[model samples]
Target: MPRIGVTGHVRLAEGTAELVYAELVATLTAHGDGALHGVTCLADGADQLFARAVAALGGTYEVILPATDYRTVVGDRKTFDDLLGKAVHVDYAPFATSEPAAYFAASELLLRRVDHLVAVWDGQPSDVVSSTANVVRTARDHGLPVTVIWPAGARRA
Candidate 1:
């Protein structure tokens, strides 16, 4: 069974959550190559989506908090939510950093631990490296294969 890593925007519009969940579940299901043991993440966007899918698949879910201060970053609500009961571990990040730095560290750590990365990118091209293409690049640099999905109507720049 492979461990899947998920990363995406936390500010998706209404109704996008369910769609994202469905697409991720479908992708993991379609792989059909092995059972997925669990998912690791910070409990937002595609991370939360993957965790829900993992539980639905009768698998475990793990969370690697990007900071020791979960209340400040992702919120206590995200960690304490009823859906996360299946988590085996919600490891705090080893290094200390702020938001963006924490993301860089967490993303790298998540990439190292998981067998595959399912990037739920917005598919937009920006002046910054926040596009789906950037996600593909980072995953490749870390040597993790990436599977990307964007909702049908979300503009890709």
Candidate 2:
């Protein structure tokens, strides 16, 4: 199975973010067909969601951490174990630190390895930095398809 890269907004706090992530996990797992493609990525929001879901669904998963070392990146010992326990290694590279040009270059490398990009942007247009546009562009340049997921509109009561 081709790997699916997930990118999404990180504005959601503990409560709402957990619920949203749970749903996304379900969605991605349903989409994973196994054998043909296995899902994987960095261990963060959408990455965490997708990895956990894919593992539960019996699909192969890989972890792409943005730090030279897992312990350095994930201070939370438990979270680090959770992520490592489930994912396989695919090289380690820093993205936001003393270096930036290096980060973007590495981002391009990781993007090229995936088959599709699953973007989860918070529907707000004000977020210019981590906007879906950046992710979409990288994925397109790498010749991978994209699947975007935003918070579903508020439910009607």
Candidate 3:
């Protein structure tokens, strides 16, 4: 029963979401299934895709919102609301507002709590603190196993 956490680019190109979802399903399946729990921020792109895949597999989804006002900060209100509805548990960081700080705080908590990390990244350098690359690096630094999934021809938006 591995607790898998997710961090990824928010802007994905067309068709990438399906690819990511398939890959996540395969990976989650391989990890055995006593109790699969996925932790995510439920953002518009990869996070939401991972949540859906986890739920489809009969696993529990746990949401870690970046801030108190995450509903307003997140891109797609409908999707965020939908995913949040399915979450078994929802927690928020201490940050009262949203931005890079709140995002980083949420990422740190996700990395700290999960047994493994799934980074849906383009394998590119991240220019910001909360970028996928930075999150992957942080996970590795903490000696957490990371599964980096970037399907062939996948591009970020």
Each prediction's TM-score against the native?
0.81, 0.71, 0.96
Q: What order do candidates take by TM-score, descending?
A: 3, 1, 2
Q: Which is the leading candidate under TM-score? A: 3
CA lDDT of each prediction against the hidden true structure: 0.68, 0.57, 0.89
Q: State, as a TM-score between 0 and 1, how close model 2 is to the true structure.
A: 0.71
Residues forming the 10-long window of minimal summed lDDT in candidate 3: 26-35
**Which is better, 1 or 2, measured by lDDT?**
1
Positional deviation of residue 18's Cα in model 2 after best superposition, in angstroms: 3.5
After superposition, candidate 2 runs with Cα above 4 Å error? 34-41, 94-103, 123-132, 153-157
Across 21-122, the per-residue lDDT of candidate 3 in tens digits comes to 899899888876647999998877899999998998989979999999889877889878988999999999898888887898899999888999998988
User: Which candidate number has the best lDDT?
Assistant: 3
**In model 1, what lDDT does residue 131 have?**
38
Tell how far residue 76 is off in model 2, in angstroms.
3.1
Please give the clash total of every predicted structure, in order.
Answer: 0, 7, 0
**Which consecutive 10 residues in model 2 have the weakest lDDT in total?**
96-105
Can you write out model 1's per-residue Cα lDDT over 12-46, one digit (the tens) per residue? Answer: 77778788888988888876564676656545666
